[model samples]
Target chain A: MRRIESCFQRLADQKRKALIPFVTAGDPVKEVTVPLMHAMVDAGADIIELGVPFSDPMADGPVIQLACERALAHNTSTRDILDMVKTFRETNADTPVVLMGYLNPVEVMGYEAFAKAAAQAGVDGVLLVDLPPEEALDVKPLMDAQGLDMIFLVAPTTSDARIKLIGQAGSGYLYYVSLKGVTGSATLNVDEVASRVETIRNLAQLPIGVGFGIKDAESAQAVSRVADGVVVGSALVNQIAENKDTPNAINDAVGGILSAMRNAMDQ
Target chain B: MSERPDFSAFPDARGHFGQFGGSFVSETLMGALDELTAMYARLKDDPQFRADFDYDLAHYVGRPSPLYLAERWSKQLGGAKIWLKREDLNHTGAHKVNNTIGQALLAKHMGKPRVIAETGAGQHGVATATVAARLGLTCQVYMGAEDVERQKLNVYRMKLLGAEVIPVTSGSRTLKDAMNEAMRDWVTNVDDTFYIIGTVAGPHPYPQLVRDFQCIIGREAREQSLKQAGQLPDALVACVGGGSNAIGLFHPFLNDEGVAMYGVEAAGDGIETGRHAAPLSAGRPGVLHGNRTYLMEDDNGQIIETHSVSAGLDYPGVGPEHSWLKDIGRVNYVAADDQEALSAFRELTQVEGIMPALESAHALAYARKLAPTMSPDQNIVVNLSGRGDKDILTVAAIDGIEF
Candidate 1:
């Protein structure tokens, strides 16, 4: 089993829900990303969803979009994010790191080359926000060949037919978008998410980590009741955005919010 | 490249047009695309769907748009006969309405209660809104904030047609951003929403479906050309912005061995300056907005910000079919700088008494250059994709005048 599957298995044995914190790899600055990744793990994050900044993040709202702009302004590429993962592996080898982004950068770099390089960089999983399983024929095999998990997002609108296909294709835990709007947009209905997560659980055996619209620790705690994992993105990225110029403060700021959510989920 | 490709076999069952187009969306959108694909496949041959589409084109969209020979402009050029396929005369003042009407009909048939689209110049937005209004469907059009500022009149036009125009303010604040926003909306509202993509880009079924709908331009132009010029034109030219208009005119002529095809891109300042949006002319192949196509990008694989005086032609990527056609040596992709397009826009207005859309002016500008080099017996048909009425304010600003 991959690190992601093992991580989920360990959590399931302990009867503990996993806490996943997402942050853009090069948001604010590149020099701060490795430190931030380490900090996220130290803050009791079971998984670190490192965002590889894309020029156009269609699934994201203004918070993550602006985070991408800040990262792009520094000309941060997927290679750089992979290098950051390599750096994180120097001190940490157990915490699974998932590189999340759109499909263009990996596509431009040739899927085989990216998968090979990612394996060399000690990457555990990849979640291409735009690449559905139907179109992942070229990239998925390469990632699987390297023993890397290919994660997928299941939205509230995803039908049961597609959920079965996603279950068959995807290897890592599925990320469930909790709402109908873009990430960072308001209004999370816990009841609706729990019901959909139930449906998804019945279809796919993989752990479901609910992302999007889970802003605060309270919301994360609520989502953790029905989800195997809770992913907090915009709220952490908002802290990173708030502490952009002061790179030293980002670790504490992102760590503080994620630590609160981790504690809240653990409770 | 030596052997000609079978155009009929394109976009194989997997939606690969020579490895250029595919469904690159997330799982959430993949199901929606599959449903859309099945619906489009079913209705493509349905008699009722065909009749409804034809009725809209003829009565609602004013089909058989005149194939007027620009005699005065041709004489001024003094080389070749220049024929204008006046798609600008359509009800919504652009060929964009052709695809919109067809998609709206599909939306109605699919029992979708709403339709959404992304637009840069607002021409597509207005056209989509117009169709939705006539069909009594709720419409929402995503446009870039910069475009909303530049194309204020078109923004108002779309709103008047009952669309909620949402201004996207991310990623250089242009058409690419608007498309991203629209895709987000579609993923969020997949149950009751049908996304009417305004270009020949995006995932599968969309490029094919849009082409099938807009193919009327080429069909009408072909019949008119045979009637007026007594032969197929030497060349067919149209501006390409995601290449809907150009592909619309060029798809029907792909099998005509004697007729050459040119797809023009907007060379904003000049391609030399590296500030233009002429991806096919100067870019490399990459994936963006769902398909692998020619794209302007930086060395790090990030999409480069593109510029163009015409909002419609300002995207960093072109259509996948155009990319396939370019690679196979079937279509010659070219570019027209902003100044050249403006000059053609002015010349066509003053000389031919028809003001063309800035997007169409690119084709006219290229035609002007090519027409001056050919014999009078030879002819070139330029797809006048839209009217300049929506672009009057932008054109007026260049002359130090304001509305």
Candidate 2:
């Protein structure tokens, strides 16, 4: 809890929105995963969210789904993702890493086992896209006991009563979806998101991370101006997918976006 | 030396024919799959569930549809006799209602108050919405926006049944996209909502549960065939679109070695044109929508868009169990192109006075071709999977004959 608090405190001190870059482990190639994490950190990514590949990812769009298919082709598993995190921690321990995915892989690995494995892998948080706060109560205690933050998504449709429940239960930061549809959808209601984030902030002090449709530097900047962190997922995954066959294209594309978003957020 | 063929068994423990059925999903969905499996196991023995399902099958959906002998068509073909299993007469104009009724009962028994489904051609959506309305459960259906336009009447029917139809405009904007959206809804509302999968696919219990529900088709056909002809038909035929209707008609005869099972898939153009949905005929095994099945994919393993005159048959993948059956050599999977199916669609309407759904016409086309080769003493039973009332406009548009 203190470590989590300090992570947020550092964000406050910086007075700049944290850049959370999400990448599916083993996307282009399985072997490049560790180096990719290091590259993102070097490129000024504040927090790294490693996506565990699942066969059916309902919340994702074609970009992430394609990335997941690429990862699965390489036989990426929960164990492989955890091992990648462990290797990531070996070089840089201060930077927080979160596992963002659906619940099936974690449930398959068993809750206690996943919690322990995640902690051992130096994972500070987890965000199960499909698990609502009410349904998460069963697993939240386990993750909380293991010192792993269980991040929850607060959409525009979320009621005030539900927002209070999610805010109280969620740890690390609250994920505010910028749209009603799945990831990579074009419609982004910035005003709605800002107000929803403000509404959620009124209920809790947890850092707010805005994502879903924050595709470009301008959108990231717009979101970061209000929220504590800006999550760039589908955009990065889309870049990786377009350049999957090219050599070192993923790193350059992702690095460029992160640099641009980081600069924009700093402004 | 090759071993002698034998076929006196049901789906093996893994829901397979030989190499066809097995649970192939990521570990997270195992619990839900297991829960469903356990529920199905208990429900199989529960007299109340069976009684309720039987009641609905009989009175509600108007089951025990006649097994009519098509004497005129069979005599014209000058070969084997042909028997029609009249699943088209089922309520909502298709055999889809059989599985829907069974699953709706299971949903109610499981204490789920809401039902969600995905549709491609809208037949399954209409059936699901119809049952949900009857049971007083809230229903939501995800359909591709393209499908919504092509199947506008069925979409309206679903809305009239008090169900919300969500148009999915993602990915290919077809059946696969609708499936992705539906899966998302299921994951979000797993606790209180029952996902009424429309076919014999998805993770474990769904394929098994749906097949069991639809097996009534094969079971009734077998009894009726025996009573009418005093012997099993030489060939059993049905169209394969995710393999539900085919599986329903084929499961009972799976044990009869002498009975040949033919599952016809849609070849939109010719297979050479690369615009077909013939999974078993030309596809590789890959994971999609929770199961490892035969799917049309590119070299990079990305699923490719498939085409058929019938929107229902325009899915890239076939049921995994069908893949197993093909592997074991128990079922001969064949393809019928759009022109062939269209001709059969016209033939059935003109000769038999029955207009078959374009999806089902593929099997009728194949059966018509096979009839000329068989002896007069032989008999073939074709599953009339659905009525063509929902597809008249589609069929007419394709033929440049506006209705």
| Candidate whose DockQ is highest | 1
TM-score of 1: 0.96
Candidate 2 per-residue C-alpha lDDT over A169-238 given as tens digits, one digit per residue, 9 for 90 to 100: 8889988877655678775778887888888889877889988888888998899888999998988888
lDDT of 2 by residue, B93-158 (tens): 999999999889888888999999999999999999999999999999999999999999999999
Summarize candidate 1's per-residue lDDT along A1-267 as a digit string, tens digits: 688999999999998999999898888889999988888888889999998888988888889999999998888999999899999999998999999998888878888999999999999999998788877887788999998999998987788988998888998799898877788887689999999999999999889999888888899999999999999899999999888878899989988988888888888
**Where does model 1 sit among the CAPRI classes?**
medium
Chain A TM-score, prediction 2? 0.96
Model 2 clash count equals 4
User: Tens digits of per-residue lDDT for model 1 on B1-403?
Assistant: 5677789788888788987998877666777788889998899999999998998789988888999999999999999999999999999899999999999988988899999999999989999999899889999999999999998888888888889999988778889989999998987888899999999999888889999998999999999999988999999999998999999999999999999999999999999999999999999998888888999988777898998999999999988999999999999999999999999999999998999999999999999999989999999999999999888888888999965
Model 2 misplacement above 4 A: A1-20, A24-39, A43-267, B1-28, B401-403
Top lDDT prediction, candidate number: 1
* lDDT (Cα, 0-100) at A68 in candidate 2: 85
